[model samples]
Target: MNEFLAAGLVTALVAGFLGGGHCIGMCGGIVSALTFALPPSRRHPARIASLMLMYNLGRISSYTLAGTLVGGLGQLLVSNLQEVARILSWLAVIMLILMACYLGRWWQGLIRVEALGQHLWRYLEPLGRRLMPVTHPGQALLIGLIWGWLPCGLVYSMLILALSSGSALQGALLLLVFGLGTLPTLLLTGALARQVTSFFRQPLWRQASALLLLAFAFWQAMPLLGFARELPF
Candidate 1:
C-alpha cells in the first residue's frame, strides 16, 4: 500500500506539472477574467496573490472530492467483481493515451469526449459569471469551486487514474498531489498572464508534456502487461 501510494503521488505530480500548458489553455482565460475583476486600486501584488491562492485551493478541493467519489466507486466495483479491475485499468490507459495525443498535438479526438460536459457547464457558467467581478476572498473561492467543474480532457484523464486506484483515500491523495503540482503555474499565470501563457503555449512544451503523459500510460500498463520478472527456480 505504501509503495502504491508513493507511485501514485509521483505520477500525479508529474502529470499535473506536465499538463501546465493544457492548464493555461483551459484555465488561463478564467484566471485572466478573475484578475481583471479587481478594481484598479485593489490590484496590488499581495492582494492578487492572496485571491489566486484562494482560487487554486478551492479548485484543488473540488478535485480531491471528485477523486474520493470516483475512487470509492472503483473500490466498490473491484471488491465485488474483481474482474472489473482489469477493465478499469484498461480504460484508464485508453484515456491517458487519448489525453497524450491531444496534448502532444498528434490528435484532438478527446475534444469530443470533453463535449459531453457542455450541458452541465451551460448551467454552471452563468453562476460563475455572477460570482465574477470578484470583490472578496469568499467570492474568489466560490468562483474557483465552480470553475473546477469546467470540462477539460486533461482533468478527466487524471480522474481516470484516481478511479483506478480502487480506494477513496488513495484517489483523493492522488488528485490533491496533482492539483498542488498545477498550483505554481496557475498562480504565476494569474500574476503574469500574457508572459506565462505565451511560455506554456509553446509547441515544444506541449510535445514534451504529451510524452510524459504517454510514459504515465505505459507505467499504469506495466502490471497488466505482466512485465514482472519470473522467479529463477
Candidate 2:
C-alpha cells in the first residue's frame, strides 16, 4: 500500500486508541450493564468473552457501513470537485488536531460537536431499548448495532477522516482499523473496568497519545502543502 493510505490507517488506529477515555465515559456503563444482562449461568470468563466479541463485531460492522456511505459520497465529490476534496482533506486534518486537543484536555469544543448527532440518536435509542437485557450473542450483536449510533465526538471526528478518504473501500478499511484499535480497551472493560479506566485516565498517557496524534495530523496535512507526494511503494 502507498504510504498515504498506510498513514491514514495508522492514524485511525491511533485515534481510536487515544479516544479510549471518551469510549469509557460513553460506553463503559452500557458495557457493564450488558455483562450483567447475561444469565447468571453464562457469567463465566469464556462466555463473557464470546458475548463481548459479538457485541464489538456488531459495533464495528456498523462503523464500516457508515464509512462506506460517507466514503462513497467522498468519491463522488472527488470525481466532481477535486478542489473540494482537497479542502475536505485539510478539514479532516484540522479535525484530527481538534481531536488531539480534546483528548489532551486542552479544549472541549468537540463535545459541543457531539450535540449535532443528538437528534438522530434520540430516534435510534428507542430501538436499542427494545433490545434490552441482551440474552444471547445475537441479541448482544443487535444491541451493539444500535449502540454504535450513540453520539460520540471521537467517532464523529473519525467519520470526517473517513469522508475525506475519497474512496469507499479506503474509508471502510480506515474505520475497520479504528474499530479494531478500540477493541483492546473496550474488550477489557467488562473484566477490568477499573484498571483500564485508570490507565487511560492517566494524564501522562493522555498527553503522549495526544501529542502523537498531533504529529500524525501534521503529517497528513503536509502533503497538501506540496512537501511530499503520496509515497509510492
- Candidate 1 Cα outliers beyond 4 Å, as residue runs: 229-233
- Model 2, 1-233: lDDT tens per residue? 86657888988998888788878888898788777887788788877777788889889898888888888889899999889888888989999999899989999899898999999999998988888877678877987888887888878777888888898998899888998988888988988988988998999988998898899899898888888745434
Per-residue C-alpha lDDT of model 1 across residues 45-86, encoded as one tens digit per residue: 788877888888889998899889999998998899988878
For model 1, what is the error of residue 228's alpha carbon versus the real structure, in angstroms, after optimal superposition?
Answer: 3.8
On lDDT, the candidate that comes out on top is 2
List CA RMSD, all candidates. 3.2, 1.7
TM-score of 2: 0.94
**Reference-based lDDT, residue 140, model 1:** 83
TM-score, every prediction = 0.94, 0.94
Model 1 TM-score? 0.94
Candidate lDDT values, in order: 0.84, 0.85
For model 2, the local distance difference test gives 0.85
